[model samples]
Target chain A: MALPGFLRRERIVARPGFNRWLIPPAALAVHLCIGQAYATSVYKAALVEDFGTSQTAIGIVFSIAIVMLGLSAALFGTWVDRNGPRAAMFTSACFWVSGFLVGGLGIETGQLWLLYLGYGVLGGIGLGIGYISPVSTLIKWFPDRPGLATGMAIMGFGGGALIASPLSRQLMSYYDPAYDGTAGTVPNGDAVAALFFTLGAVYLVFMMFGAFIVRVPAEGWRPDGFDPSTVKQKALVTTESVSAKNAVKTPQFWLLWTVLFCNVTAGIGILEQASPMIQDFFRTGDSSTVAATAAAGFVGVLSLFNMAGRFAWSTTSDFIGRKPIYMVYLGGGLVLYVLLATVGSSATWLFVLLAAVIISFYGGGFATIPAYLRDLFGTYQVGAIHGRLLTAWSAAGVAGPLIVNSVLDTQGEPGSLVAANYRPALFIMVGLLAVGFVANLLVRPVASKWHEPHSDAATTPTPARSAAR
Target chain B: MSTSVSKDPTPNGQQPVHTPAALIAFAWTLVGVPLAYGLYQTIKTASTLFTG
Candidate 1:
């Protein structure tokens, strides 16, 4: 029987003014704010001065925030799917703002625990929820353009830190002026507190924009001209929807997890220590020279590349397929890491170029994976699955910084960061990427058992289903 | 792919039909107001943190 006309109108109109172009920008607004997590390094100096804390201790704040982001995403992914993106984003805004306010209070009171609770726990919730809200919806809206759609959102995430780093530095400088006579001294903690509050407020507004604009396409709707068969032209792993519980049981999930972990770890290792690494590599005994500023600018330049690559490479995945693009990320990344280990200090530009490329892949990996999940698991439960997969990111966040920092810290002297200093870390990244490369190759098409065909008729096997027999 | 494979045939189809403007407005309020309020609180707190 044909469905009623009123029902059809209701269904068609539910799709609203939604188009592919709108989805990416909506995703970008939220992603850009969450991406500020990348800029935490820029604030390290300020934190150390204000709190009289060690670098390792401050690093824990980032670590906690990242872990919580994964955990919260896993916990809330189902709620997002049920209640929709608006609810999730609103919740995110609340937690994120409270985190900033609470963190500011902590800073003023010189209480490190509050800082952890505020920024790490509360803010992390915001990151996780905000991060996943737009992904599945955008994919559904642009089934034909999953890679491009998700990439646009994820690109904002990667580039967010590019804007944040400069903004944060400026805010820090404005609030905490350097004392002329005192080395490494910061002004009152009040300024820093004020800055955090301002950031929180601004982030809330941007995130709200994302929440307001985002809407899910009505069920079963494809773009007017798209053909689903074209999705197979790119990758072999595409499958119908699988529940999140089932997705976790599959080997593909684990393999993709490893891929994301290796990519993130390798990129973050370079990014976290970029400024200091450059200073140590090319120090010419002039502490106040233009070289120092130039090196910082170089780090900023890498940020731009990292940001652009998220959009560019991930969008390319639509054409070339996920597994092949990852081959480039792992294989090309390994070569770059090797070059850095063997001949990095020989020329500064080589190190910069290689680092920029690796970081881009790292950011690209994040931006691309939501679409990849949509391909592998189907859109039915992808948001939850994506949320669950983020546990890999939390793990990488810890592993990357640990490998880089522990190796460097163990070397003791600041000047000891010569080519030899990073040899072990670089090799470790290479080995990790190789492992990921193999894992990517092992991925196969999802099996029939995982597909969630609606209604019991799927199981009944009518003559239409049994015709081949 | 064989015709037996068939495209997804779930009710409402694969694409979402148009959402009522009222629903969009309602959804926007659900997300937007809290966020704006949060921002206001953040700004207020920041000013206090800096000035005080």
Candidate 2:
């Protein structure tokens, strides 16, 4: 009935004085491995040439993965809450690395569906389970600093792309030295396949570190000095917990869903268009004032902001309360987007600075949401609630781009568009942020009807620690 | 139950146990080194945009 002792639940829960600090790194390993989802563009160009497919076609692979990420997370979330971190992490590791292996085989044999099946369907499932595995556990361990703890782990997701993109490029080049990853040059498809295999193996090792190292806190194990009473004093913070299935029925959960969806949509609007948007904003004659290399660098800087915001802003939320933290994201993002559309062309530095902060809020939105859930629902089913909430991300992943790209498409060619062309999309994003700001305002405490009988993890039994101070 | 309880610290409270500090360090290094390398590569690439 029980899983093997190696994978048993009892084996992994941290006893008192077990150094609560260790848990973040465990969560980071899984996130960093899976966060490579962002760096898909590194191989996107090569895949197009290899399959003789259109850019749109190769891009579907990533879109499929994101959708599946939302799907699997929602579906498997309760299982994760039930089974504990080790099982969820191990399952995630298997699906994640296997997605690569299968995709690599698909490349070796030249089957596009196989690649989708491998990377999209399977890998996306990995992404989902991997994403939420450590979340609830961290919140439980660091009830005092839930935002900072979850932020450190989720920040790893943003950093994953920074590591993966350059590493993917290097591996591709290694497989075929002649493949300089330039326009009109094709990467050796076999080399690309081998790169997939190598990446699969590498990520497997890294993800296993998370699978092995992760532990839930022993029941009733509060931090050395944390008092449980102060947690109840915060007006918006809930002492009552809600199950994930029941959480969906509450308006607070849905409102927060809208908040995350709007925040992600606004951020993705700029992120999806970063390279081209910058070029279009500052174009003069046939030459762009911002060079292609510089545009790429602009993305790299935004990536850093994205990573930094995940840690920085989310940590800030621990002190500022989650709702007010979101106000800054929504309200401040509106001003920044309007500035980008209105006077962004006057100065490149102005545009860059505005976009970076907005993107940071975008990253901040992802990192902070779990703690937000922990605040509303308590730790009992927070991970599952977080999983269900990520459906908002999947929705935004589709809608954010659709709104931006569809508007821009109607305007003109990508490289040829003027700053004026982006005005409609920017205005639309302002409206979305406004909607998000209102939603964050409306998020009251979860109503009493939906709450579980107990306020916290009364269900989880506290085990004996070997050495309590 | 009595076998190890005598050696356990804080018999009055929940006893504290830890994964070896060395093991925690080694495991962290396993993921940290790759992340550091990734950041290095990203910065290097981004720098070309600034300095180029």
Candidate 3:
């Protein structure tokens, strides 16, 4: 006898390889586009020189962008769940491209507000949407390898800066002909305009590639060679399916949010002022000029670590469980921050090593969280949940820069960053990481109320239906 | 043709069901334009932010 309609639907859903290979390319495209955020620091000197703006004023642009990223993610996440990844990604691409075009025009015209509107508002929305597009889709497609899948995608996000940093620098050099061999002085006018227009065109193509390649697997799809029984073998958190609405109500979501917030804040503290921070730390009176150049390279090097950590540490979470991995991220990160605060300039190598490790954990936290959600919430509406969770990153992006820049600005030191000046901020980062560690420990298995059990008819076994196989 | 028929079985032990092209096209249409627009905006936003 033929199987029931529901059973047939379930079986069809279970079919594997709904374009698994497509996930990586989609993720890389999005990351490459969004990764431009990393290159913001490169433009800071130019902005300061051209418009004669203070670092604080320029810093506000990034802060606004970060805030908007979080806000837009929280707002659009629900729509993403309802409409699917394609819609969210598409919307992300539009806002991102528009933000660039407008911001470019603003630069040419010297309208700071227009720059804020384009880059901060429009670009921020793109960041949020593009950020979440491939995460949940990869998880669903690679249920047997959720950590690996999500890690690959998230790693792309971290590493995107590696490519973007160089590309932006090159573009700035090419466009800005008066590039005196200064570390942070690029004259801004038509050259800036041309650069913006070019990036806008290129990124539009890349982000659209990601959006086009994105596809939801037919429902209930599982890896072809995988067994559902293996869920019992893995130490990973694995929950039955839950809607995004219900997932948010659980304490686990809040705890994870705190963890992400803390991780991002700690990392941003170093990231936002890396060049200047290094220059200050290593300054020995007459050695300041050499120190500044070295500092820029240090900033670039951190980007490498940030990118590598996103893949290495997060991929490791597949074997060791997300909760435990996060424990290391937070706990180990706390100790590193303490070392940074206490050792000061005397322990220069230690400081660099510790900073690199902490930043990696920060990047890893972003890469791993999607898989973490997949384990705790199931694939039902993970994309939306991931989007909602990213608000924490948005918060951190603002808080991180504010803490670092505000502290330094108050000190009013234009030349170099002294060890004594950074102590308070280092301590704050340490405290944040400690709190995140506690939150990770508090995370419990998801309660049963959230599971969307497959409908009874869908779960029933077919009778003498060998023909369908 | 006989071999192919022998290897494949319809769910009801009869002819296979095929999803219509128009339905697929409609679904794509619902998603395609919005996605394209988002990409455009992302590029526009980033370029403007950095350049401006």
Candidate 4:
């Protein structure tokens, strides 16, 4: 469990006058690289064609990676906290880069399991670890603005797909002379494999940049002009720390979990079906009005909203408080889903507006959760608790699509279905959001029974000596 | 069981230390350019939703 000398948590503590501003970019470096997880759809058809397999088989590669992201984060959360961001980032880069290399090898040799093992398992571990690596450190560095700090980093995950999607397509086209990066032109497996190698090499430099530059704030470090007591005056902003082990035992944790699950589930319903859903909603008959290119554009617009909301809403949470923000995401989202189900087909613009805001809330929920946890639980062991809570995302990832897909299946076949067919699923999301609204309402500060003794008193240890332990 | 916020004075009094302006700008630019490019490309693609 001992990290090398340089990777040790003690080694990276900031000295006095160290610029806290430098930290966010470091966090973003890793996040933007791993955020490529969302870009898998770009090459999905190519993988399917080359592997001579069902879409579901290739889709499982992403599924396994997501599941592993949650599982590894939960398992490694404590170790990451016990070590530090630098070690966690280093470890994550290794697993992530290795996953690509191994996955590329699988593609060259025609082995699907190797793709699963490489990207799904190894890369997933990297995702989980990388996701939480900078969280607690960021919070400590920017206690006055936890929401803004975390948002800047987590937003990269949403934006990652934006970069990766276009990058992947261009890379594939370059690697394969026959593929023109146009519709129905699938790249060969060799090109896709080469694309993976290129991405792995590029991501290595960025992620390592993050690992080297990231620093934990020194002991007694607080931003100039910040008042901790001012933060404490807010409702549900706790100053006491809770160990991650006891965090699950608290009712607040489960409530936030449900809130997150419902928010994510509802958002994914639109996201999973964005392209087809828009076209289907606007369908006039067998032929629909919306063109395929426009539908692709709709998806792109949603991605923009998704990325923007992560930063906008989470930064807003800094002023408005975390609890009220969830009220907006869950409670407000309930109303939007209702509108999306009822009058969405009335016009294309209205439908896009509704879906864009809904997706933004989805992204906002993700960016805000860690700050929310910092509110209910103290900073101590927060990264681990955040890791544990991500299991909800893993659960929602499956549930969201299943709910929409199953409802759509019963309604009729894909591509031919009308807006009426989607009404049932949208209403179902409405109900889920209603449940999350209530869960958000019930969240209270962690009870005294769960607080670690002498929580704030433990902060006295000098960063190097304390973290080195 | 009650936890209160720590009101410790800043470790360094009177003056605050910051990373050099040039270094800060360099670091921000490192991550900002790619992010800006991605945003630009995505917006360009999204524009087709209205036009097409």
DockQ of each: 0.06, 0.37, 0.04, 0.30
Listing every candidate in turn, what is its Cα RMSD in Å to the true structure after a full C-alpha superposition? Answer: 9.1, 3.1, 8.5, 4.6
Query: Which candidate gets the maximum DockQ versus the true structure?
Result: 2
Cα lDDT, model 2, residue A437: 98
Compute the lDDT of residue B7 as modeled in candidate 3.
33
Cα error of candidate 2 at position A98, Å: 1.0
Q: Put down candidate 3 lDDT per residue, A1-469, tens digits, no spaces.
A: 4433432323333122133555566666777678787667657777766667787777677778877888877777767666666666677888888988998998888888888899988898888888887777678667777777787777666656555555666677788777743554675666666777888898888777666656665543444455567775655456467888898899999999999999989998988767677656666763543344456556655766787788888889888888999998899989988887778466556666777787888788888898888878877789889888988998888788778878777776667457777888889898899899999999887888777777866455332222110
**Which segments of candidate 1 are over 4 A away from where they belong?**
A1-13, A176-187, A237-239, A283-290, A456-469, B1-52
Q: Per-residue lDDT of A114-163 in model 2, one digit per residue for the tens?
A: 99999999999999999999999889878899999999999999989989
TM-score each candidate. 0.82, 0.95, 0.82, 0.95
Lowest summed-lDDT stretch of 10 residues in model 1 chain B?
Answer: B1-10
Off by over 4 Å in 3: A1-19, A180-184, A232-236, A285-290, A408-417, A457-469, B1-52
Per lDDT, the best of the predicted structures is 4
lDDT value, residue A128 of candidate 4: 92
How many clashing pairs does model 4 include? 0
